[model samples]
Target: MWKRLLGFDPATMKVRTEILAGITTFLTMSYILAVNPAILSLTGMDKGAVFTATAVSSIIATLIMALWAKLPFALAPGMGLNAFFAFTVCLGMGNSWEFALTAVLIEGILFILLTLSNLREAIVNAIPMSLKNAIGAGIGLFIAFIGLQNAGIITSNDSTLVSLGNITSSSPLLALIGIVIVSVLLIRKVKGALLIGILVTTLIGIPMGVTNYRGILDWPPSVAPTFFKFDFSGIFTPQMGLTVFTLLFLDMFDTIGTLVGVSTRAGMMKDGKIPNAKQAFMADAVGTTLGAMLGTSTVSTYVESSSGVAQGGRSGMTALTVAAGFIIALLFSPLFLSIPGAATCPVLVLVGLFMLSPIKDIDLDDYSESIPSFICIITIPMAYSISDGIVLGLISYVLINLLCGKRKKLTLPMYIMALLFTLKYIL
Candidate 1:
């Protein structure tokens, strides 16, 4: 029944492989379980209710991605999106939390319409192959930077902006050790190497005191405080255009960047196309729409899904496993939270290395393509944004081609995208 439903084949992806891939994906991203509530609760929202909303929304989104798209990606209220909600929308804009959620719902609806109209695919296809490959490679570096920062392996500097942390710090030291362990296992072709590295790192850190053995079980928090909460009355109020546009633009491109990056790593891209592109968009759209109604921020695909792809998850069964993990986490939050960032940080750094493999495919000979691609690959980590890097690349691609007498190379949509991103920066 499972095989028929998910189209899983032992010859291609074993049941154990998918199951492990699912759990590994969850392990990498489960930080959101605690992190999301912490950020949003600053706005006077109930933390427990936000926690339940985060977990439940993730399950719904991941299941959709698994079953509808038949791909190994997971979805949740996005990390950056949530921050924007708390910092920009709720606090900075001085809007109520309920009004902010309404904005998210509106953005989701607009995204669904765009997807149904084929605009999303058109934008994707308009992007040149060089940029696509570059997006994939850029995301690789982005993921690595995230891991390093999370584990304290990298720290902020007054002059340099980012510099190495004290390696002797217990958390950084443990993460470094985990990196070594995972690297050795991968060298030996050990199966489930990333997952093994994480669990072992957690155990080792317990003695170092970077990890705690939190109790194994807990009951879920009630969602009543936030459930069905929305300020629909103010959704159409003035001065909301920029906020709405920002949410829509960020979520759309964020999803695009993740899809391109993870798919490239998993060898899922073919002839410069993402298979089931529409289904992937639909999954995110539905997740965001339902998520807002459930009292969370915008739900979208997580780049941490790359961890699952690295774990050899090819089918939706891997996604199914991730969904199951989220469901189970409601009862085991303590256990899930116990696995510290020092442990899972290694998976991100390792999988990031895995993602960079596609850079070998980029067209280095063409300066036009190579230059923009170079800007993208380097700027992603430096700018701390995948979408920003892609936008800069796109903007440069259009201007360069137009200036180089390759105006014919730039398509109508390409020029339009370049203008849009330019406007994004300007206004």
Candidate 2:
């Protein structure tokens, strides 16, 4: 049973390799179980409720990936979507968490329809191969930016866009230590190096005063579980529906991009058909809807799981392993809380670097691909938003294709997307 679940053939790799891949995937992506709750807490949601939602959603999504998609990947609440949940939906819109959840459900429905209609394929094909590389690299830069900010290694300056924090400070020092350790291990070709760096950083931080600083370790006596408490009163309302649409659209492309790139790397694609693409998208849509109902942000695929695939994880067992780890972490929230931001920063930054490796394969001679590729790579971290970067890239790609007398390549749907992104920026 284990062999079947792990996609292992007795005729192939040893059991040790499969087990190691599972463990590697779990450790690299485990930060989501805690990070999602931390980000959601900023939206004034109940901490315990958010934690519960994150765990449940991750488990459900991973199970879908394992059983339905049967892919060597894992799913969790996405980073950009969480920021939107906090900064845009909750704070900027001044809406209740219930209203935010309603938006998620609506968007999930749209995602399902888009997938079933096969529109996702057209959208994916419209993007030049170079832009896809840029999207991957841009997301990497975005993740790295988040890591730096969370670790207090980057800060806003009065006159400039941003400035570096003092490395002499405790958080920055610990983050630097973690980064150096992880980089060294990676250079040494060590498997599970990122996880090792995180664990070591956490252990070292105890004496260096990171755990006590956040007051997160000082837990209250007994927090009860908050499960199945979905509030859908504000759904379908005009304003909330629009917001949900934005979130859903953003998440759809992000998931699609990651799925395409990772699936290609995993050898899951043949003749441009990603096997189970429709089912995978449906699972993601359902995961997001369920996540909102459970009181968390949008749930999607984790790109970091590619690192595990690189380590020879060819089956769904790796995803199951990741899901099991999330369940374990949910039960021990206090232990996770004790891990400081510095400990996890290294893993994210390292993963970001890994994602950028595809840039070397892109053909820069094609103007249609080159211009959008440049925009996509630079604008992500520069604009501090993945959606914004993608929007700009897509719009530029269409315009460039038209200019190069390759207007024949421009589909009606592509033009519509270009117009929509233009309106998004204008509005």
lDDT of each: 0.89, 0.74
lDDT of 2 by residue, 288-310 (tens): 87887777788888777766665
Collision pairs in model 1: none
Candidate maximizing TM-score: 1
Alpha carbon deviation, residue 187, candidate 1 (Å): 0.4
Which residues of candidate 1, in runs, are more than 4 Å off? 1-4
Ten contiguous residues with the weakest lDDT in model 2: 216-225
Candidate 1: worst-modelled 10 consecutive residues by lDDT: 1-10
Deviation in angstroms for 21 in model 1?
1.2
**All candidates' TM-scores?**
0.98, 0.86
